[model samples]
Target: MALQEYTEFITELFESGKTHSEIATELQRIGAQSCSLMTVRRFCSDHNLQRRNFVSDESLGCEVLSAINQTGPSYGRKFMTGYLSTLGIRAGEGRVGRILREVHQPYNILRRQGARNLNPIPYHAEYMGHKLHMDQNEKLGMFGVTHVLAVDGFSSKIVANVTMPVKNNLVIYNEVYRAAVASNGMWDQIRVDHGREFFLSLYVQEKLSQHRFNTNRLPYKQTTSSKNLRVERIWPEVNTRVNYPLKRALVDLVDTDSLDMQDNNTKYCVFNLTCQVSQIGLERAVQSWNAHRIPGRGIPNTLAAGGCPQRISMELLPSAAEAARMYEDELGASLSWASAFGTDPFSSEEDRQQAEQVFLQEYPDITVLFDRAVNNDLSLFQDALLCLINATNRFA
Candidate 1:
């Protein structure tokens, strides 16, 4: 059969950076159109679908720089190559490494010689939702920023994540746990560190244990953060991609006597702004990570895109309202969604409104502000601090 009939489908797979062999195999697997690798290659050649036909090294280097800026300089040759492929830039690892050395020598050296110990502990998961790993990252906790993420073990996909001023139990329950359940259905078991912040989430997980796809195993397990390998492994990436850069900027502010960590008002403004920016970085990191193909495994987002085995009906799971009711019953306190990040930073509601107005007037785009800060533009941070301080004083 002529390959032209499957032109659109094959083009999509090719544009997704799949090799001729993989595309041909997929075509055969789906029984759409069985074609040999040579046929697929010839077809691609005929249609001028070559990934590097006219691309130049200078342009590729520019793309590498842009990717490095967004993902930070920690990505090695292999990962960077994969990341580039995800962007439909089919550069080889050797070429990517050469460019990385020329573009970011310092970071490349550090990444190559970085002291990273491997965890040899054995881990197993039956299916995509077999085991859910939840953990909190406090690398930026000193800056009054914390991040919580839930990762699916089998697929290594981040199912849910949230940024907050602190590890609030209610926020973890509502944002991370419930959000994962709402999006992907329930997991067979949840593994977390032994922290009180997970109390509410674990409580609800246990309550819904009976409805789990597999009830033979325990509903949840509390272990050391080091042992929670699935989620723990992501912290370093988070540190590199999100926390460290932001921390450096924040530290610069403190060293320059521009930010006061001890002051409640200053902490409040810093936490709110930093958390918002950190969340954006975290989201980008997650996107890059999910789409980047794993060495032996497939792309995380693709592998986990298909719903888990033993599909559980949504009606069987507790609603958000019902989960809140359960929280009230178990904790003997009213279920509250309050969080330090959400709490008013100013003295009064009116002051908070005025400060927000001033902030918006000065920095309308938080993302732009974050990008500037990441690039070592401390002036923006200084200006933001001044804007908030002056705004709060206006209503004081």
Candidate 2:
């Protein structure tokens, strides 16, 4: 029954969700040893098990809630407060709000529905607002939901996305407002499978009336899983092409020892500041997909602003053209073949001859696409030949 042994037991208890005081009293009850609150807290910190939701009122409210729950059913804070006082538990109004929001949450208390459904198009407003399917999912490394503003999974286009906490309806509307601003105006209909925390926000009606987008919203819950989400496809491409690149640019801007640096902060800053860069990045991503990097993903690269090229390259860089030429030579066809099956995938005596004729007739002998605009090195262009792949490879 050493103090250290007692402390170890107390730490285990705390890890098991037992309070410090409970551990203290229990240790003394077992006639082992006792520790102070400060020791218990320090141990918690050392183990990286900081107390969750450390608001004073939160802990206080949980105490109050536990007391009330043992007694009877008190629907919300107001009912619980009045009921608790009958048993001599008195708390202030401000304290209730804090406790309710932070500690004893009334929202998640009840499990109403598990899965969400996508109902048939209800009698809703016409055009612009019809069946804009919405879903939420998280990204790796950053464990936060990326609220997807989508339409049909078959029609994969990112209408909007919010990469922040969705606290309530007001917060969601504010995010929706930001997304709408990015997309010109409000959408007509918002079709969701589940009733989210922000579903009740009057922002939908208020903003609709103000901007006169005259939008209406409808919710359905055919299924709970967000598997068939068209917006999810964008996340992978975006992670690879947009988000990862942006993350890298920012990392490299500060990475003094980085062997691969993109000049100064200009490249990183461009994406952060201008929607144009975002638009172009999005376009290039679609183009990459169109190149059939995946089995099927070719689609329009139309961005918000007028069609601007994301892959802005100067005259073909010498190295880029050389690489392009090497790719062409290995393929034994013009640059067109290099554009299609990469440098070399398949070669047949007859197919090679046909490819040579096709490259000469249909595609130019030496077409040029500016190289990867890397490291503020627009001065260096990677000449990639754009030969159309087999039409069968086209993805909608």
Candidate 3:
């Protein structure tokens, strides 16, 4: 009397309105071994021959259904399982899976096809400021703008993001790196592509070396974007949220020729306007990105358990003077930096006069040397220029 042999007959009797106890008793009367009621019940349940009763309570059921509609068909059993937990439901994955199947929710999750080999190595940093990723996106170049971004490898928080007319090294230094470092402080290592825009790797190394910290340059060439996943992931969001809208606006403006789009000056005016709007959109996108919750982590970068990158990197902030000096060295005399530095450092006329007096008192002999140079007095240093240098150094 094998249970497998009785599966069909037992299913038929159970479907004919026979209870588990009655079915088990009838089988035993035929000397087909003593099958308990529990055994029969388990068999029917496992074989799907028993009718599953839906939950009578509609309170939690209504909430779950509402979540299904809100989350869309893309969400699967796993996501719903976690979501239900967050909603204070005690249902397990198995229960949630059954409910999803019963409700006929399609598994429309958009996923890449084909199998990918598992990577055992981790690409994340253990602490904030430990590592940062730098990357540039040129999809918006048709509008005469490029976007450069920096992201923290640990918190995935965007440290700096900027829109520039070109992807030159000077622009990258002034707009991207400087802005990020100013706000989030210095990072131990910066991982970027081997593009020339980041060619000042040696310069960065030199700056960090002054503070007794060895700045590691992780410049990858011919490598996949997976290596810089932290920053690479941000491009898609930026494109969809910011670039797409800007592109549409630009196209509309061109179609309308609202501001004399043909004239060079007018074109530039419109270009600048578009660039400004693009910049604002980029900023808002970054803010929203930092505030949005991370998958599996369940917290925004700003409120992460490990602390935001800016907060964790508080010690690395450079003074305005120091930051200015760095920008000067990295980018040379750019228009923006020139405007910032060439402007008067003195606040008032009295302060300017006092500084001028101090400078004249310290280097009074500078004028004498200047007058001599103007007179071409070459005989003053017949032996060597070292004496003239010494005199300048020794100034009265």
lDDT of each: 0.80, 0.38, 0.55
Q: Model 2: how far is 4 from its true place, Å?
A: 99
Worst 10 residues of 2 by lDDT: 379-388
Judged by whole-model lDDT over C-alpha atoms, candidate 2 comes out at 0.38
State the TM-score for model 3.
0.45
Candidate 1, 218-329: lDDT as tens digits: 9999998888998888888888767877888788878989777787667777787788888988887776677667767787888898755545566655655677677788
CA deviation > 4 Å runs, candidate 1: 1-59, 78-98, 102-106, 315-321, 330-337, 341-351, 373-379
- lDDT over C-alpha atoms for residue 32 of model 2: 56
Candidate with best TM-score: 1
The TM-scores of all predictions, comma-separated, are 0.78, 0.27, 0.45
What digit string (tens of lDDT, one per residue) describes model 3 on residues 239-356? 6545654565555545665433344433333333345546755664576566545655543354334432433242454443555567567678432322110123345667555644
Clashes of each: 0, 11, 0
Ranking by TM-score: 1, 3, 2
Between prediction 2 and prediction 3, the one with superior TM-score is 3
